[model samples]
Target: MKNKTVAFIMAGRRQRRRRWILVTSFLALLACALCCAMLLLGSTIYPIQDVVRALSGENIKGVSFALNTIRLPRMLAGLFAGFAFGLAGNTFQTMLRNPLANPNVIGITSGSSAAAVFCIIILHTSNAVVSIASVVAGLATVTIIYLLSRAKPFSVGRLILIGIGMQAMLNAVISYLLLVGAEQDIPTAFRWLSGSLNGSQMHELPALVISVLIGTPIIVMLGKHLSVLELGEQSAASLGVNTDLTRMVLILSSVCMIAIATATTGPIAFVAFLSGPIAKRLVGVGFSNAIPAGLVGVNLVMAADLVGQFAFEVRFPVGIITGILGAPYLIFLLIRMNRKGNL
Candidate 1:
């Protein structure tokens, strides 16, 4: 009997590890393929060799100019921003054990968006200043939400509800900012509001890239703690998880990633809201889905951008495509959660 139990446990562990490997590899390959397509499939498509050569710092006429000055930055922006949104969104979902507790749901992106729109319209700020303000505003908003929602028992429902209210208020603020802005600034503000990579440049991506590079590993490393966190606060505390510190670290790291991503891409709709559940459903239970979620995010953003660019007579921003995809799911989730009394 003891031998049988040991064998069963071992098999379960092996199976879980196998699933993780398969899911991670599949996501990685999918991301690479999408990235290659982004680089090679634009108008006046360039070959792989030219793309490689341009990446290697060589000048190859139109190919070099196009790849370096255009495709590369756009691709990188989607890749990094998607990863940030995915990672951060999944972290929130996992930590809170609620599918609706993502950054988009909880007003973090809206907070960033409101600040950026304000900077663009009212303050007449540069993009750099707008980005900084967006990040600061995102952090501030989350902090306020946390304080307002923190109770003796720490209710996830309260946090989510507060976030939703904050999101609505911030969105109203954004509309007012737009309403009062100069006519000349409206176009730029509107484009940013829609969440675009239209004018993405290499120079504007450093903060996002750096945040992802620094924060992703930390979150991935804390995946075990996050899983423990999902087990309820008292249980996690009993298991020596340092609940408070872990939550703080996860929140701060996730916020930084989402804020920078929002600043760069204008809150890209529902990438954050959709990535976690998809990754989990693919990867299954018993394994961390942080990296897989990020990769899924990258794939979603890149693919959605492609659809927006070529699917319609009118080219929509990436956010519109993602928004269309996400809205139905959000509605379904709300309905299901209501039925289950998880709301």
Candidate 2:
């Protein structure tokens, strides 16, 4: 009884620490800093007061135009899309029980990208149509992947392996489309593929914002069930978790947000892949890391964009930098998983 009391007190202290909340707050603050930097430190520096004034509908000559039109939209795009990528990516990683089981690895982004590329190169469709097609394609791809992975008793490893194969095939399709695309259309396709924020406008921001806002809450509310699901089907069901309903809701919500984000920012490389692990590592276990993961996603996309803009002689897309950061990690993860006989 004394030992039990001591352990209980220690556990209470750890819970009171509430380190997850503090970490989440820090990430939010950092994301805000990056957003402010993106706004103020563009071609010309604007004072904080002027930025505030411009944001509040005051029409300063040059500062207002730049802030309200260009910088604001770009910053918003990165912010919303990053959150979506992070939330969706972590959802997949947690559900599938594998870090490599993200949208990027599982061909969800490729499905959206492929559909968008086809619209740009072949159909010559409007951006709205492209966005619609991308969303539809993403949903279809996941459905197909899920069905294929459901053969017999269900295997997470089989699902991931199948996703990797699908990703490879989709990548090949993207390369072929790029090759056969018209010369003049090639640049547009390439830019979209590279996941750039150049010329981001207010019109493109709504879909991403709305989807993320709606989906994030649903995921957070279902987070408890989601954590249960991570314990596997038998255990989760034994705990009275509605495995199918919870999974369907989580998958649909995550895929919708991810598709909209991919449409907006061109997948942004591994923002989804890296955010969850980093969040899990920081926040430790026995706590929901969804919000922290999303915040980490925001920081990565914003910071990577800034680095791509100023860290080198030539401007690179945000995806390129993230890809550089994620590839090494992917290799390390693969080796580690193989050694553990998980691959």
Candidate 3:
């Protein structure tokens, strides 16, 4: 009986692993398709051959200029930034074991936005300065929220509450900056604040790309520890996990990726908030959802961008479309959580 039970358990495990692999693979392929759509389905639709030729450095008149100059950067911006937000968002949700603990709800994005706005309006700094300031400010905001949440015995609920408070405060500051900003700067600041992918140049991509590349491996390498951490701090420690070290590393890596993505594209709405749960639901349970989450983020941003570009009478920002999608889900999640007494 014991042997039979062991065999059954092993078979179940194998089944789950297979399912995870298949689902994750599907998500990856979907993301790739969305990326292709982003590149191919703009105002003047370019054929696949033209896109391929243009990508290969062939100067095919209008095709080359349009693809190389405009669409490629936009696609890349959505791909990398979406991946960053998704990965970081999943890390936070998994580590904190709360759906509400994402960077979006926790003021991390708000912190970066406030800093970027200040740079744009008051300081009138360059994009580089704004990016740097936003990163520093994001890191600082997380640190502050973490410190404040560490009162006596730590509480996830307390941390979330504090984060929400911080978000409110930061938003007020952003409004004040807008009010005092020069008329010319207001449009620029508003555009950035709206979390747009417009005018995304290739030059502005390296920092975000590098951050995602570096941060992703670290997060995935620590995936097992992250899963263990989700079992509560004391339980994780008892299982020989260094909860503090793991938590800190995860937070830092996540914050860095998210901050850089925010700097690159202005905190594309709720990609961080919505990616993890969606990935978790799609990929199911037996493995880490990080990769799938990132892929889902990529698909969401790219698909949303495509919709914004062509779905309406006028082009809308990617963020606006995502917000429209995410807000209703947020409301539903809150109601469900409240009903379950988890809120």
Candidate 4:
């Protein structure tokens, strides 16, 4: 009997490890494919070799304009933002053990959108100023949510409800700002409001990349702690997890990534909220799937952007496409979760 038990345990452990390895490899390959697809997509097609050459420091004129000046930065922004959203969303959902704890739900994206809209419309700040304003607003929004949510016993539901209210109010302010602004600024503000990467320039890409580079490792390194937290706060505390500090650090890192991404690309919608769970489901993993989540986030943005580009005469922002895709799924989740008393 003892020998049988030991063998069963060993088999389970080996299976878990095998699943992790398989998921990780799949994510890595998917990321590579996304990069390649993004490089090759657009009004004008460029060869994969030319794309590589341009990236490798050889300038091929028209190819340089096509790859470097245009597609590369946009692709990088989508990649990093999607990854951050996925990682951050998974962090919150795992820590809180709730599917709806994504940044989009928590109002971070709306907060950034509110500020970006204000800058573009009322402040007449375009180009760089809009990004700075968006980041500032996002950080502010995070602080507000933390305070509103830090009462007793930490309720994720209260946090989400308050966040939704705040989102509505901030959106109202954006509308007011637009209402009072000059007619000429309206189109630019509209673009920002729609959460498109259409106006993204190469200059804005570096700051975003740097922010992601710093945050990604932090989230990855905390994977074990996050997994432990999923066992419940009591168990995590018993396991020496310093639950509060770890959670705070993860949230801050996630916020920074999302804020920077929002500033760069506007609120690209549902990438953060949906990618983590979808990836987890695909990998048939438990809650320790933030890495796969991030990869799915990347794949989602690239795929959605491709769809937006080709499906219509007018290019749609990936955010709009994501909203269309994610809304029904979210409703389905809510309905099922409510029926199961999980909400």
Candidate 5:
């Protein structure tokens, strides 16, 4: 009787999990369709038929160059970068089991901003140079935060606190640079800081896409290790899970995604922080949907970019839209965390 009940419970859990995945997968598809709609339904309003033609090879007069060159790259960049950030962010939060353990909450994005700010203002560099600087800075920030938080063991809470401090310091430097920069240079610095996927070049797209392709699978493949790690380090070790090696590999792979995304587009915003929680609610809590989180990130970036581009006269970066949306979610998370005594 006891064995039968246990088997019944397991079967039920599996069925429920499958349902959860199906629901989230459907939502992801919806978001992707909406992205295409936004791409086509811009100020010009190119019909989907023409858009598809231009996308394939059937050049459609004036729409071809505009859609293919301008909007397509921008749309794709936002999509991929958002996906990368979301996947990475969720991995960290889930691995650490802390709501605040996201790429944005840490100084990672700030590092990119700081480097890009310096390049724009003092270096007077071109776009390529700025992107390079952002990647370097992102790596440095990640390294610092990782080192500071890791002693004999890992502590997610301490890591977040330190990351917040580091972010504040980086922000102060960026602000100071902007303040003293020549009038013309300030705008460049300002734009990089704000995070935009606008004006994405066709050249960068291949490289960015390739990086995502490479790193995404590594994240997905590591699911087994993640599951083990969730069982606690000692338990994982006893169970033949190499905790240190897995953590290192996961961190490296995630950083690659982040650096590539940040380089291609500016570090957008809260997709990383928000996607994991949203996807988790849809999927089972025990399963890690790093890919799903990435898709959510992609949806977030593309959607925000579209809204920012046409929703207002100013044509803001996708980052601003995300900031507006994410801030409220973050506050709610904070309140909830407090209520749960995790704060």
Candidate 6:
């Protein structure tokens, strides 16, 4: 009986692992397709041959300029930024064991947004300065949230509440800045606030790309520990996980990735908030869903961008489309959580 049970458990594990691999693979392929669509389906559609030739440094007139100058950077911005948001959001949700604990809900992105807006309006700084300020502010915001939540007995609920409060405060500051700013600067600030890919350029992608590349490995390497951490502090410690160090590392890596992505693309809405749950639902429960989550984010951003670009008579920002999609899901989630008494 014991041997039979062990064999059954092993078989189940194998099946789950296979399922995870298949699901993650499918998501990766979908993301790739969306990226291709981003590059190919713009105002003036370019054939795959033209895109390929243009990518390979061939100057094919209009195709070269459009593919290299515009579409490539736009696709890359959505790709890396989406990955960063998805991965970081999943890390937060998993570590905190709450759907509401993602950076979007917790004020991290708001912190970045407020700093970026301040730089745009009041300081009139360059994009580099704005990016730096936003990244610093995001780190500082998370640190503040963590410190405030670390009372006599730490509580995830307390942390989330504090984060929400911080988001509200930061948002109010943003509103005040906008209200008092010169009218000329308001449009610029609003464009950034709306989270666009309109002016994406190759020059602005390095920091974000680097952050995602480095942070993703760190997060994925710590995936097992993250899963264990989800079991609570005492349980994780008992299981030989250094919960504090692990949690701190995870938070830092995730914040850096998401912050840099925000600096790059201006908080492309709900990619962070929705990626984890979608990946989790798709990939099921056997293996770490970090990669799948990132892929899902890429698909969401790219697909939404495509939709925003062509779906309506007017061109909409990618963030607007994501907001429209995410808001409904957020409402449904809240209602469900409330019903389950988990809200």
How do all models score by TM-score? Answer: 0.98, 0.96, 0.97, 0.94, 0.94, 0.98
In the order shown, the candidates' Cα RMSDs to the true structure are 1.0, 1.5, 1.1, 1.8, 1.8, 1.0
- Candidate 6 Cα errors over 4 Å, as ranges: none
User: What range of 10 consecutive residues in model 3 has the weakest lDDT sum?
Assistant: 147-156
Instruction: Candidate 1: list runs displaced more than 4 Å.
Output: none
Q: List where candidate 4 sits over 4 angstroms from the true fold.
A: none
Model 1 CA RMSD to the hidden true structure, in angstroms: 1.0
lDDT of 3 by residue, 1-343 (tens): 9999999999989988898899889988998898898889877888999999989998898999888889999999999999999999999999999998999999999999999999999999999999999999999999999899877556889999999999999999999999988999999998898888899999999999999999999999999999998999788989999887888899999999999999999979989889999999988888899998998899889888998989999998899999998899889989999999998
- What TM-score does structure 1 among the candidates reach? 0.98
Worst 10 residues of 2 by lDDT: 12-21
For every model shown, the clashing-pair count is 0, 0, 0, 0, 0, 0
lDDT for each candidate structure: 0.93, 0.91, 0.92, 0.83, 0.82, 0.93
User: Which of candidates 2 and 6 is the stronger one according to TM-score?
Assistant: 6
| lDDT per residue as tens, model 1, 144-186 | 9999998878888899999999999999999999898999999
lDDT of 5 by residue, 50-100 (tens): 888888898789899888888877777877788789888888887777878
Model 4 lDDT at residue 199: 52
Model 2 has an lDDT value of 0.91
**Cα-based lDDT at residue 231, candidate 4:** 82
Deviating ranges (above 4 Å) for candidate 5:
none
